[model samples]
Target chain A: MLEAFVFATILFGFFGIILKKNLMMKIIAMDVMSTGVIAYYVLVASRGGFFTPIFSGETVAYADPVPQAVILTAIVIGFSIQALMLVGVMKLSRDNPTLETSEIEKNNTP
Target chain B: MNQITIVWIALPLFLGFSGYLLPKLDRYFVLGMALLSIAYGLQRYVAADTLTLELIDSFGVTLVVDSLSSLFILANAIVTAAVVIYSWQTGKSAFFYTQAIILHGSVNAAFICADFMSLYVALEVIGIAAFLLIAYPRSDRSIWVGLRYLFVSNTAMLFYLIGAVLVYQANHSFAYAGLSQAPMDAIVLIFLGLLTKSGVFVSGMWLPLTHSEAETPVSALLSGVVVKASIFPLARLALMTDDLGLILAVFSIGSAFLGVSYAIFETDSKRMLALSTISQIGFVLAVPAASGFYALTHGLAKAALFLIAGNLPSRNLRELRQTPIALPLWILLVLASLSVAGFPLLAGFGAKTLTLAGMAPWQEAVMNVATVGTAIVFAKFIFLPFSAQPEAKEGKKYTVGFWIAVLILVGGLVAANGIYMDAYTVDSLLKALIKIGIGWLIYFLIVQRFILKLPRGMEQFDQLIGVMSLMLVLLFGMMLT
Candidate 1:
């Protein structure tokens, strides 16, 4: 059930990216999609158990540490990419001001 | 001794970050790194031992240097050296050298890494470096192009990450050997992501625009080596599954035709070269055994052509006719163009022959047709008038970088004689001539007749995302059967 919901979040983000004409909206949609993927990784990590991965003399099950570690790196990468995209968007807005995909395309073509 | 492969990845990265502080010597730093990498690659190739270094034993992150990867490392080194030399005359910013050096390291890392997790990190590093390089011009237009490239590339990589997670869920390992236990859906997702990165078919539609818009040396790097980065992984995947290989064959052939058709109609010289890169890469992907060789030859020749294109007064095909090139540069252009067109005695012919050897009969026929199309596309450049123009003396001054790049390419062509000796057969030569003849005839007949235009909407960002999603669904459906 949780997997289905996570997938829905991903699909929703994709739809937003595909349907949104504004460049800023598209960037946001991309972020949402990345967040959904990260959530999916978290869910995967949780398959081992719900408890914290750090062992402290507890008998309860602990989540998989590998996926958590992997996703941590992925999260850093994702954040940096998002920052770069936003910076690009800020630069782009200076010239066209509207930041509409159509207007940018018009200016791009010869 | 086995751990030496790590230095290939480490040295450039160290230089890339540290070179920034020493801005005046950044170019020399990059040049030294490139030369050192080439020396290391040569030493490894001559030793001919497959070296592997385990980073974290449990995590399966390994660095490997085999014959195939060593060749790529060598190619990357040579191209990096040539690009650095070329950029010297262009007077590029210190930032460009930093990114180029970092890109060299990341590309080498991508080739050397042995598992999915490490490969992902390396690819992301490459993406970031390439993004910075593309946007180095700092124009409104380049920023937008770089942004689109990053967004689409990251989205595709996220899908790849999800696929890697799926593989881990099933197999409990990220190594290529563990792929045998991977689910079909996971493989399909990985395939789609790599397809987009390699600029194959619908998924890679961003390539032509992004490659053409960048500065000349950056375009050379993008088309020459960066685009081939994903193919290394895809080739590994294809080797593990016959189904994936079949799928690769289909998409590669499609990409070949699509790229050539676009190139045949393109008026912009750089855009035409960018499109031809898509097509030539198709040849590389078509045959796994020949991929390394084909990629090396194409990388050298294409980088030379792009460096030469940098010297042109106008990029438009019609405008180029009014200006005649100098004799020496004209010869260099002819050699590079013919080599790319797979002329006998040049490097591309041997690579093309090897690629053709692995294809089924029908696919071979299609490849031959695409070969002719490639000829037609380059014929536009080959037949340019070489007569002296009044402004040619002042308008065109060949720089030191230009000569250096051409020399590297020429030397590469000369060295390729050993590899292509077996491909020199009467029947193969005859077939190559016939293809070129047909292509030349077609070019002459339709020189001014056809004006083809692909849909503008297809290249738009939203449409690209839509196309990628649709391809995912389609590939998943195919995998079910």
Candidate 2:
């Protein structure tokens, strides 16, 4: 049930990307989508248990370290891509101050 | 010696990043690295055994250098070298060389990496570098194109990541060998992501726009080699399942017809070339066994053509017809264009034969029809007149890079196909001639009567996402049955 909800979150973000006319909203939606993916990985990692990955000298189930490690790398990559997109948005705004998709499209058409 | 596999990816990356410090010498450094990569790739191609390098054993991160990847490595190296050479006279900024060289390394890594995690990382690096390259001009339009490319590609990759994670959850391994045990849904999602990246069907609609809008050499790289990044892994996955292979085959045929139909009516010369890329890439996807050879042939030929397009005075076909081209450049254009149209004795002919050898009769027939369409599209180039202008001396420096690219293309054809003896038989020659003749006749007799435009707004940003989601649902439906 929780996994289904996570998928909904992803779908909601994706719809935002598809439906939003504002470029900034689309970027935010992209972030929302990626965050949802990251959340899904987190949920998967904690499926075993929520205990620390390090040894605690007790008999306890620890969360999967692999997904966490992988998601860390993913987070960094996602951050970088978002930064690049933001930079592009700023640059694009120079020509079309509104930053609306329709306006940008009109400007782009030769 | 297997450890040397890392060098193939790392050298360019190291040089590219460090290039910021020595902006003046960066181009030369990248050029030398590209040449070294080609030489090393040749050495690996000649050797018989597959080499595997284990980078992180616990994570299953390994680089596999096999016959299949060696061909891609060679193609990537050659195209990089050609792009670097072609950009010489254009005087691109240091950042351009940096991104180009980085893209080269990441592409090589994507081809050789074995596990999903490493592959994802490599692909992300490739995407970053490609985005920067596309936006290199800093113009508003180029930035918009780059952003759209990034958005679409990133969304597709997120799907891929989810699929990768699902596979891991099922099999407890992220390696390609572990994919056989993955669930159907995971495989479908993965295939969808890869197909998008490879510029197949609806998801690939961004290709023509992105490829046509970038700088000339960048356009050559994107069309010629960058799109092949996902195809290597996609082919590997298809090899594991018959259902997936059949699905891919259907899409490949569809992409071929769609691309050529677009190319047949496109008036912009560069845009036509971009559409033809989508068509030729379909041939690569159709026959996974021969994909490497087909990609190499198409990559070299397409790169040469784009380099030639850079030298042309105008992007419009009508304008091109009015302006005469230098004799030497015109010859090069004809040779490269003919090779892409699958003329006898060229690299594309041999690649096409290999691709068709394993296809069903109906698929083969459809592919042949697409071949005629391809010939018709390129016939526009063949009909162009040679230089009648006395002032051709003004831009002679530009032809230097064109000569270098065309020479490498011809050299690649000879080296790879070795005269293509089997493809040169009378029956095949006659078939090729007939196709070319019919294509030209159609161009001269029928196609000149109309000016057709692709329905507007299909390739826009929002529509792209909508189409992608529709494709995901469609793929799910197809896979379920």
Candidate 3:
């Protein structure tokens, strides 16, 4: 059932990228797509059990910790990439004073 | 925990940051260190056995250097060495050197990684470093192109990450060793992601634009090896998915034709070379066994071409007669162009002959057209130095680096004679020579006459993105049903 949501979110993101003329929105769509994937990973890792992953003396079944840890690193990487994209968009907007990707090149002030 | 493995991965990155930190001493220090590192690396050849350096056991962040990767590592070393030497004069900024080093380390990491998580991280590293390098000049068009590359590639990488998730859900491991029974959707998604990075048709439309807009040496590296870093993984993926072979062959053939056709239409030298990269990559992907060898030879030759393009006084195809280049540079240009066209006695010819032995006749014919198209495009350069006006400034270091690259493209055949010699028979040599002859004839007769020309509409970003969406749907349908 959750997998369907992942698909829907990915579809939504693709629509934004394909339809949106503003570069910032396209970047947002990229972020949304990554968010969908990250959600799916966390959901899959927790399927076996719901207990805390931290180990204790008692034997309690626990969820897979790998995906959570992996997601953390992935999140950081994604954040940095987003930052870079935003920086690029900022520079682009400053140069053109417009948000439209197609118009930016054509209406260059310089 | 091989000590050499650590050195191979870490030294470039270490030097990269140090160069940034110590700008006054950066030039000589980094160059001397690079030379020293190359001297040390040449002493012993790394064998194929897997060596895993585990960073985190649970998430599978490990680095693996196997026989496959060792060869790529060797190629990367040679290319990086050449780039360092050539960029010394052209690359004015210390930050450029720093990015080059980090790019080297990131590419190495991507090549050597053992698990999906490490692969993802390494790929991101390569992406970020490449973005900086592409934007190094801070020119308006370059920044915009780099941004497009960033957005497109990052979005594509999500497909790969999602694929990894599905693979992990199916089997609780991310290692390549356990991918045999992975879900088909997961495989398709991963392949789609990689195809974007690998510069295959439809998906790789941004490559030519981005590569052509960068600084000349950066463009050389992009066309030469950065694209191949993504291909290394796809090569491994091919081994696991039997269904992918047919699809890959078809796409490779398509890309080969598209790339060469576009190259024929392109009048800008750098853009033409960029288009040819897609074509050459197509050739390598079509032949699996000799893909690595093909990539190495292509990298050497393509880098030499880009560097030569950098040194040219004028780059327009119409200005070929007026552009006065040195005799040695002219000779080097011909050698590089001929090598790319698969002329006999060159390394590309050796790779082509070996790979063609296993291809179907129709596929072989397709590759022949690709070769002809390459020859057609580069034939423009044959008359560049017709009336030498004055030699362009050529630095001694840059010239030496260019010659070394050409030497590798020629000498690599002798070095790997045992593996490739059986395929280099008299019949194969004659066939290669005949192909070149035909290519030249077609160029002089048909292309020069302007009897055939392809529209340049696909070169635009807006149109390419539309095609990319359509390709995704078509590829998904093909893979699933």
Candidate 1 lDDT, tens digit per residue, B1-481?
Answer: 6546556578888898888898898999899988988888778777878887876655666777777777777778888899999888777878899999999999988887778888899889889999999999889888888887888889889888888888888867778766768888788778778888888987878888889888888988998899888988887667756667777888889899989988899888998999998888888889776788888889888888888887777799878877776667778888888888889888888888878877899999999999999999999889876754435455567788779877897688658756658888999888988998899999999955677766656788777788888889868876776
- Over all chains combined, what TM-score does candidate 1 have? 0.97
Q: Each model's TM-score?
A: 0.97, 0.97, 0.91
User: Across residues B1-481, which tens digit of lDDT does each residue of candidate 2 receive?
Assistant: 6656666678888899888989998889778887887887777777847888776545667788877787888888898888888778777888999999999989988888888998899888889999999999888889999998998889989888898888888876788877778887788778778888888976778898999888888998998899999988987667756667888888898889889999899999888998898888889999887888888888888988888887687889988888788787788788888888888768888888778877889889989999999999999999987774536546445647767876887678656776245777788778888998899999999777778877747787788888878888888888888
In the range A1-110, model 2's lDDT, one tens digit per residue, is 98998999899899999889999999999899998899999998899999979997897989988988998998999999999999999988888788899889778855
- Comparing 1 and 3 by TM-score, which wins? 1
- Candidate number of the best DockQ: 1
For all candidates, state DockQ relative to the true structure: 0.80, 0.80, 0.55
Q: Write the per-residue lDDT of candidate 1 for residues A6-107, one digit (tens) a residue.
A: 988888888888888899998889888888899998999899799987778868888888888998999999999989888888888889888899899789
lDDT comparing candidate 1 with the true structure: 0.84
* CA shift of A90, model 1, Å: 1.1
- C-alpha lDDT of all candidate models, in order: 0.84, 0.85, 0.74
Q: What is the lDDT of residue B83 in candidate 1?
A: 90
Could you tell me how far off, in angstroms, the CA of residue B238 lies in candidate 2 after the best superposition? 1.5
Candidate scoring better on DockQ of 2 and 3: 2
| Segments of candidate 2 deviating more than 4 angstroms | B388-399, B419-421
Pairs that collide, model 2: none
Off-target runs (Cα >4 Å) in candidate 1 are B388-390, B393-395
